[model samples]
Target: MSLDTSTRGFGWRAVQFLTVLVYVFMFAPILVVIVLSFNASQFGGFPMTGFSLHWYAKLLENESVLRAFQTSLWVAIVTSIVCTALGILAAVALVRYEFPGKEWVNTILIAPALVPETVLGVGLLLLMRFAHQPRTMWLLVLGHIMLALPYVVLVVQARLIGVKRVYEEAAMSLGANRLQTFREITLPLIMPAIVASLLLVFTISFDNVTASMFWRPSGVETMPTEILSMLKISISPEINALGTLMIVVTVGLPLLGGGLARYLARSAR
Candidate 1:
């Protein structure tokens, strides 16, 4: 091997090593949580305190966690649906049509994602106070929608931009109405992006804490809020169990959704 070739090979190997190290650093905490979930000890630390499902059982039995989980689930579901619907429409319009101040409109639509979450949360709280609207699940839902909408719009819009107008125009030339063209051609073409947006919005809403912290009313707690309260009180193995379950669901659902999207895309082709 030449000297220059050996140096280049060493540089590439160093890059690969650093990439793996970065991944390990990011995932190590999650791996620890998964491992600690089965720890029999009440505390969440090392030393292999014997494997047991005690915390998982406790997580199941905890009414607070169950209620919080339910709240988070419904909020995420509603936020995803609303964001996806609005996002698709906004994305389609933004990508397909030109209007006066279109750039400004696009910026406005995506501004929330640029703003700090804490700032948004505080601003929402103030708006609620000024309006005399009580903090409630609906309020939280709206806040989450605002937070997730920009991401949904950006994702779906990027996909829409990549799509050719020829497909839609061809459908229209065949005497298909705008609605029919959209329903038959445009929607399917963007299904993967829509699916991705749904998963992203749902995950964001479900795992939200900063906004939920400001907007959650009395007697209402989302899973993230519940976890925060638990931490404030004291750490327990149950928290680890809860974290593990959340990690599984969050990672698993997106994978499933992505696979389904891929299958649908293939079928459409």
Candidate 2:
């Protein structure tokens, strides 16, 4: 009995320590940024002189940063919608039906997941140029979609498989057509995954630097692109403020969205 109790105690300690370590690993950088954002030093760093919101106020007035933020928002939003929809369709087709080269087709759909962003970005840029395409918002949108689609498809596909088609089958047996059955039953059931996938992809596109860097217009910028440009100059408190804002936003979105989704899901049931 003493041996068993000791072993259990050791296991609990191991789990607790692992949890603490994982959280520290994840949140240490964010904690530093949050603390440093308030530092009065013109440059973000330790041994703070004073705490002030000066940098955030300046950030509000920075036209270039604002423009880049706007550009990133629109691109991420459009990319999420387009890629999520395309992903859902492809995932549904692959999961719910069988056709020629099904495995091959699925593999191709998942190609971007493993492909290095730099290589994909360069290849896409070259492909667009060869097609005589202008560098535009649409091209950026397409690039983001390509980057995001694999993830969206994978998330939705996993949910689809887990949802137990028996429920959809029952809906069909009740005289619902294929389209109606899918619309009413399958879609609603997996809506959580769809929403999660959209948010995740949007965040990915919003935060992506290397790929978007290549595709973004020379003068135009996204938040990540702007951050890259700023890095070329030097670190500033304004950058820290921006980083703090993003950290808050990134943390808020999942919590808010996940709660809302859960509420709806429960209400639906």
Candidate 3:
């Protein structure tokens, strides 16, 4: 028994060590970028020349960067809203009802995420061309919605699957209608998942580059694409500053959403 206990402890310790290593591997680059954003030197490297907020200042002063940032923010916000609404409806239909071609509908809805980004981007571009539609922000928004829909659907559907229908039935027995039961019970229960999906879709849309590249209109740019263009010219510390800010916003949002979800879940319980 002592030997078995020792083996299990060792296994746990090993797992903990591996988990730490994985986190370090994932965050090491972000750490480097954050550090370099504060570096006084223009070039990024180890052994910082000094500390300064010059790069961050430059980031604020750069009009193109600001424009791109705004563009990305706008797209992310719209994508999140549209995707969340559609996702909730789709999740409800898929989970609460059975219809003809349900399987095909589910497959088609999620197929965008399964397909390669390059292929999807190319196809979208071709479709737009064939349809004689001019490239526009709406097109980019549509692309992001397509990309993010599957994730939102999956998250909400998973939450719905674990939820008991008895709550709705109980509400109905108390003289509540379908809409009333949903608003008072089902909606509150699913609020956490919806919030989580909104935050997740926002992040995905903001960070997307490959698919956005094809859909971007002339004279328009997203932060990711702007960063790519800047890199082709030269790596600037300002990019690092922008990246650090993005990391903060992206990481902070999901954390905020998680906290909100936890509170809602506890309150619902």
Candidate 4:
């Protein structure tokens, strides 16, 4: 090979190495938490601090933690449902229609995803105060829906683009109305993307601390809040245990989901 070509190849290889290094750097903190979760030390740390499941055991009996978990779960669930439904509607309208101020509507729907959580939180808080609304779980759900809507709309829109328009028109020609065609045909075809987007938004809401913090009332707390308070007063080994369990569930379930989806697709074909 020419020297110039060899030099170019070396530069490309270096870029790949740097990209991998960046990924590793980003993941290192999470890896450390997973490692320290198994540590026998009262304080989670490095340097082979032994191994124990005592922290995990404590987590099982922690009522406050369990309550916070339940609250987070419900908030996420409610937010996911509301956001997904609204997002799907908005996306369908945006994709199908060409009307006045259509681009403006699309921009508003998508703007939330790009804004910082803190900015959204503060803005929501101010809006609530101006409208005389309380900082409650319902408000939290509303904010989360707003936050998750953009993601849901974006994902569903992309999936919708892949669907053939003729399928719906065919259904319509066969005496099926718009509602019937959508319920029977369009929804099922884009179901995978909807499900995936819902799960992702649910996870985002459950794991959120910033937005929750801004919107929460004095007496209420979520899992992330509980974790943060625990860390501030005293670093608990139980946090590591919680972190480890989350890692297993979030990381492992997605892997399992992909495999199951593949298996189902194969079976269908």
Candidate 5:
């Protein structure tokens, strides 16, 4: 018994140590970038030459950066809205109804996520060319929607699975129609998941680089593509500053969305 207890203790300690190391490895580079973003040095690299917000100030003054940010924001907003709406419908159909080829439908919907971004990007570019379609903001929007829809579907579907259909039945039994029942009962229950999906899709669309590279209209730039351009030119502190801001937003929004989802889910229960 003592031998078993010692072995278990050692195993637990090893797991904890490994977990800590994993976190450090994941975050250490991000931490370095954050520090460098605020560095007073003109260069991006480190030797800790005091702290400053010069790069951030430069970002504020740069029209191209602002324009790219606006473009990214617009795309993210549109992608989230469309993805959430379509995702909700798809999740409802998948989870709440019986249909032919149901499994196939689900697999098809999520296949884009399973495919490599490079392949998807190239495929999209080729398709556009084959279709004789000009690369446009609309093209970028569509690509982002395709990439983000699966996540929204998965999140809402998971929530829908946990939701008791009996509530909808009861609402319908109370003389509510199917649409009415969904609006009054089903929609509320799944709202947290919808919100979470919206935020998550926004993050995905905003941070998208690979597909955006292929789909973006000529002479246009989103923030991610803009950063890539800047990197091609030079590794300025401005890039680090922009990166740090993106990290805050990309990391913070999901956390906020998750917490909100949990709180809302608990309240619904």
Candidate 6:
């Protein structure tokens, strides 16, 4: 091999090695948590120490965990639905219309995601206090919706941008009203994006902790907050099991959504 060819080969090999190292570094902790969740030992630590589903079974028996899980599920569902509905309307308006301060409106809509969670949480708390609003599950739901809305709007907006205005015009030319054109032609084109947004928003709300801590009622706890309380005392295998389930959720929903989006995209074509 020429000197230049040898140099290029070594460079490519170095890049590949670094890429693998980066992925391992990122995922190793998650893999360890998953493995340890099945550990039969009383303490969470090194060595296999045998394997069992005892931790998972214990999760079922823990009333606090179950209640917290239900609370988290309810918040996620409400947040996702609200965000998806509002996101679609906001995205369509931003993409399809030319109004004053449109850019500013877009910026304001997505600002929640850009801001630090601590800042957002504190701001919302102060706002609630100023308005004489009590902290409650509804407040938690609202916080999650704010955090998740940007993602939904961005996803739906991208899909809408890819769609041609001519399609809507064509439908209108055929005597279809604006609403009919949107329902029949535009909605189908963006259904995949909407579905993906729903799942994405659901995952975000499910995993939220910082904002949840600020907005949740005094006695109530969501799963993440409940897990935080557990950590205050000790690190138990049950926590690992809970973390594993969360991993399955936060990771799985996006993967499932991506697959479904791909299927829908192909079907639309």
For each candidate, the alpha-carbon lDDT, in order, equals 0.92, 0.89, 0.93, 0.85, 0.93, 0.92
* Model 6: per-residue Cα lDDT at residue 29: 97
What TM-score against the true fold does each predicted structure earn?
0.95, 0.92, 0.93, 0.90, 0.94, 0.95
In order of listing, the candidates' clash counts read 0, 0, 0, 0, 0, 0
Model 4 lDDT at residue 173: 99
Candidate 2: tens digits of C-alpha lDDT, residues 100-171: 999899889989988999999899889888999868888888999998899998999998998888888898
lDDT of 5 by residue, 1-269 (tens): 24565557777889999999999999999899999999999988978799899999999999999999999999999999998999999999999999899999999999989999999999989998899989989999999999998899999999999999899999999999999999989998998988898998999999999889988999999999999999999889999999999899888888988899889878887
* Candidate 4 C-alpha lDDT tens digits along 120-145: 99999999889997787888898888
Runs in model 5 lying further than 4 Å from the true structure: 1-12
Least accurate 10 contiguous residues by lDDT in model 2: 1-10
Q: After superposition, how far is residue 233 of candidate 3 from its true place, in Å?
A: 1.0
lDDT tens readout by residue for model 3, 1-269: 25555557777889999999999999998899999999998786666899999999888999999999999999999999999999999999999998999999999989989999999999999999999989999999999999999999999999999889999999999999999988999999999999999999999999999999899999898999999999898878888998999989999989988999999999988
Query: Which run of 10 residues does model 5 get worst, by summed lDDT?
Result: 1-10
The alpha-carbon deviation from the true structure for residue 245 of candidate 4, after best TM-score superposition, in angstroms, is: 1.1
User: Which of the predicted structures, 1 or 4, would earn the higher TM-score when compared with the native?
Assistant: 1
Q: Which stretches of candidate 4 lie over 4 Å from their true place?
A: 1-9, 260-269
Off by over 4 Å in 6: 1-7
Give the clashing pairs for model 2. Answer: none
lDDT of 3 at 233: 85
User: RMSD to the native, candidate 5?
Assistant: 2.3
Question: Over the stretch 60-168, how does candidate 6's per-residue lDDT look in tens digits?
Answer: 9999999999999999999999999999999999999999999899999999989999999999999999999889889899889999989999999999999999999
Worst 10 residues of 1 by lDDT: 1-10
